[model samples]
Target: MPVLIAIVAVGIVVVVLVVHLTGGSHTAKIANEDAAVERFLIDYPDVEVRQCFLSWDRRDAVLELEDGQVGLVHAVGVNFLTRLVKRGEMTARAGVSDESAVDLETGDVAWPRARMHFADSAMARTVVALFDKKVDTTDNKRAA
Candidate 1:
C-alpha cells in the first residue's frame, strides 16, 4: 500500500509539472482566444469581427472580417503584430481560388504583406456562421 501511494504521488507531481510548463490544454487556448476577441470587440465596437484564428501558441488572434479583410491582435506582452490594420491599409487580393487561403496586401509602403490560411473546414464554416449572424443583427438594428 505504501508503494502504491508513492507511485500515485509521483504521477500527480508529474502531471502538475507538465501542466505548468505547457500552460494547459486546448480548452485553455480557446478560452484565451475568446477573451482576446472580447477585448477587440470592445475596442472596435462598430467593426465587423467575423472570426478569430488563434496562433499555434495562442499568443495572438488573427481577426477576419466579413469583406475578406484581416487584422491581428497580440497579447499584452507581445509586440504589435502589424500596423496595417490600424492604418486601414489591409486589402484582400483581387482573385483567389481557395477560400481557405487568403492573401493580404497593404497599400502603405511600410506595412508588410501576409497570407492567412484556415486549414480546418469546420472552423471556416463556424466563421461564416458568425459573420452571417453579425450581418443579420446589424441589418435588423438598422431597419428598426
Candidate 2:
C-alpha cells in the first residue's frame, strides 16, 4: 500500500510539472521573445543576432552573436521597468554607442533600440534568430 501511494504521488508530481511546462504562459513568453528577436533582425539587416538568452528573474533578454557581441533587450510592458524609469532608476538612450548608430540615410530605422556589449552565450541565440539562423534551445550547450 505504501509503495502504491509513493508511486501515485510521484506520478501526480510529474503530471503537474509537465502541465506547468507546457502551459500557455511559457509558450507566450517564448513567442514574445521570438517576435522581439525577429523585429530586431528586420530592423538591422546588416548585423546578425545569434543566440537568445532569456532571464525570467530580470525580465530581460540578451542576444549573443558570432562576432563576439551581445545585445540587451528590455521587455516591453514590464511594470517594474516602467516604475524604475519613473523613479529615475533607469534612463532611456538612443544607442549603446554612436559608432553603429542607425540613421534614415544610413542604418535601418526599423530597429527599436539596440546596444552593443561584450559577447556572451545568451546574446548569441538572439543574434542567430535575428539572421534566421538555427537557435540552440538546449540549456547546457553554448552556441558553437
Candidate 3:
C-alpha cells in the first residue's frame, strides 16, 4: 500500500510540473522577450538592435543586429550585465569566448560570448514564433 501511494504521489507531481511548464500565456512570453530586448539595448547602446530573443530565465539573450549579425549576451543576471558595462569590461567589440577561456591581453576577465540555450522546447518555439511574426510584419510594411 505504501509503495502504491508513493507512485500515485509521484505521478501527481509530474502532471503538475508539466501543466505549469506549458501553461504560460502568449502575452506573458512576448512581454518577457520585450524586456530582454530592452535590457540588451540598455547594455549595448551603440549596437543597432534589429531583434532579440531572451532565455526563459532572462539570464541570456540572442541579439540580431542591423548589419545581419547575430550574437549572444549573457551574465549572471540582468543587473550583472550593467555592472560589467560600468566597469569598462564590456564593449560592443568584445568577442564571445568560452567560459573556460581567458583573454590573453586583459588577463583579468574572460571574453564574453553570446549564445542561446533554451530551457525547453516550448521556449524555443516561442522565440521562433516571435521571429516569424517580426519577419512577417517587416515584409508587410515593405510591401506597403
* Backbone clash numbers for all candidates listed: 0, 16, 2
How many angstroms is residue 68 displaced in model 3 relative to the true structure, after the best TM-score fit?
Answer: 2.4
User: How many steric overlaps does candidate 2 have?
Assistant: 16
Q: Which ten contiguous residues of candidate 1 have the minimum total lDDT?
A: 75-84
| lDDT per residue as tens, model 1, 1-144 | 999999999999999889877855323332466666676666666667666776445554667765545556654332333221532345544226656544556464654554544555445444334323233457658899
- Tens digits of per-residue lDDT for model 2, 15-80: 889977776224223245575466556544555656565554334555554554444454443221
Give residue 143's error in model 3 in angstroms. 11
The lDDT for every candidate, in the order shown, is 0.54, 0.42, 0.48
In terms of lDDT, the best-performing candidate is 1
Ranking the candidates on lDDT from highest down gives: 1, 3, 2
**Evaluation by lDDT, superior candidate among 1 and 2:** 1
Residue by residue across 1-144, what tens digits does model 3's lDDT show? 999999999999998888678763112222465666666667666767676656655566656666444444455421334322211222222113422211112123554344344555555544334323123357668899
Clashing pairs in 3: 72-114, 96-113
Q: After superposition, how far is residue 26 of candidate 1 from its true place, in Å?
A: 20
Better of 2 and 3 by TM-score: 3
Please provide TM-scores, in order, for all candidate models, with all chains considered together.
0.37, 0.30, 0.35
